[model samples]
Target chain A: MEVEKKQQCSELLQLVIDGQATQQQRHELDEHLPKCECCRNEFELSLSIKEGLKSRLKKPNLPSELATSIQSKVLELA
Target chain B: MSVGESMPYKSKDKQRVFNKEFMPHIDAMYNFAYRLTLDEDDAKDLVQETYLKAFRFINSFEEGTNAKAWLFRILKNSFINNYRKVSKQPNKVDYQEVESYYNSESVDEKITTDLRVETVQHMIGDEITNALNSLDIDFRTVIILCDLEGFTYEEMAKILDIPIGTVRSRLHRARNLLKEKLVNYATSMGYKDKRK
Candidate 1:
């Protein structure tokens, strides 16, 4: 597996999504993404996949009985 | 054990708060527990115990802190202090035994057809899941956290109590492993071989 030289924009794109981008980095990527085709597509794809996953995650409902029992146990320990 | 009593606390008013707030979180906790314990029954027991401990220590939950993260903190502590009985975790699978590096590499006389590409693409999701399940827990958890759960590298570091560099490197390894698995599954499914 050859390691491709990671573009500054790719790094920035990841940082921005993770909310770890600094002001300068964010500004730079914001400017770069429109001009950089690969970075733009990558960012769009990741964002779409993220949203799709969250939407598709089935309603995380436990059984009502499980809830009742766990709740009692929670309060008991409290 | 409540028998036919209609479950005494089932009617308690604060019970609504518990149901609405804490219960839905069990699945996530179960998933995380499975990763740590690697046994369904043990994971289930750990989850139940974690919930019990959470209930006992619910008052210590500071209101403003993210409740889910707090709950995870409690659960992680429980695994570490109470249930990670061994001094160290078991030996992991030697990735070398599984790594088909020659196949992973681009080479002559191999793999360049449209039908194969389509088949490979189609099985990506399930293959990725199997690959993830195969990796050592640490690598798999980082991938699940960063890629699947969309946690920031820093957040993953905090959750796993590792450094950010470890998170990034592990994420890279995990993703590559998934890609390899997808390719192998497609090939071994004999989709590519039969057409040739």
Candidate 2:
């Protein structure tokens, strides 16, 4: 059963990212990552890359004056 | 002429009416305007113009409709009518050409896979802005809607006034193209060097 499970396992790092890996798949991945140094490197690399991309996409600052002006303008109608 | 055809001519008299009705929508309108114009000043003016138009046609608005959706419709029409300028650059990437390369069975069927957000995130980020800027107008809009704004497939079709199938196909192709670009970027950027 374990050998069958191992053969069916996909890349743990990717399945984790895609949100498609099942519980069994995760268990297999956890087991593999400790013995597999290469996968460990992949996990760290993926984390750094994800963080950098997310950081670059910060929401544009809505200037306070602009917000106030827009708010006052909108509220006047009510 | 239709009843709506003669309404816009009356905006001059309805300026105050428009201001009262749409004043509160300025910020959201500005955001949508920016999404369309990609320029802050242009977006502001677009919102202003939309407010004026909505005011003129306020008589046509239903008593209990989605005001935001109506406003966005007006903003979209304004962009289409006003800024349909032609650009001469060709920036196209067709993903169907490379679909043959992916082995469906090889994509690792492991349950709970280990794809980390951090792994491909930066790889995609470096070249994404450039790649997005290069897509044709239609593709760029869809890519931004789904990938950036996270709009659902149905919502996109309604916003673009297109079929759902077109949205799905375009999204699928756009993602693949993005993935291809990011993979290449990762390989070139010391990712592969450390592996070596």
- Which candidate ranks first by TM-score, i.e. highest? 1
Off by over 4 Å in 2: A1-58, A61-78, B1-28, B86-117, B123-128, B184-189, B193-196
Q: Chain A TM-scores, one per candidate?
A: 0.71, 0.52
* Candidate 1 CAPRI category: incorrect
Residue lDDT tens for model 1, B10-96: 235334544555566787877677766666666666778887765555445543345566566667777777656662564653445
Model 1 ranges with Cα > 4 A deviation:
A1-13, A16-65, B1-21, B35-39, B80-121, B190-196
Q: What is the DockQ of each candidate?
A: 0.21, 0.10
For each candidate, the alpha-carbon lDDT, in order, equals 0.55, 0.52
Candidate 2: tens digits of C-alpha lDDT, residues A1-78: 143333233234544543446798778778877886545655554444434433453334334466455445544543
DockQ winner:
1
Residues B2-112, model 2: lDDT tens digits: 124333324343445445555566655675566556666776667766766665567666433445556666777787767545324343334454243222322222211
Q: How many backbone clashes does every candidate have? A: 5, 24
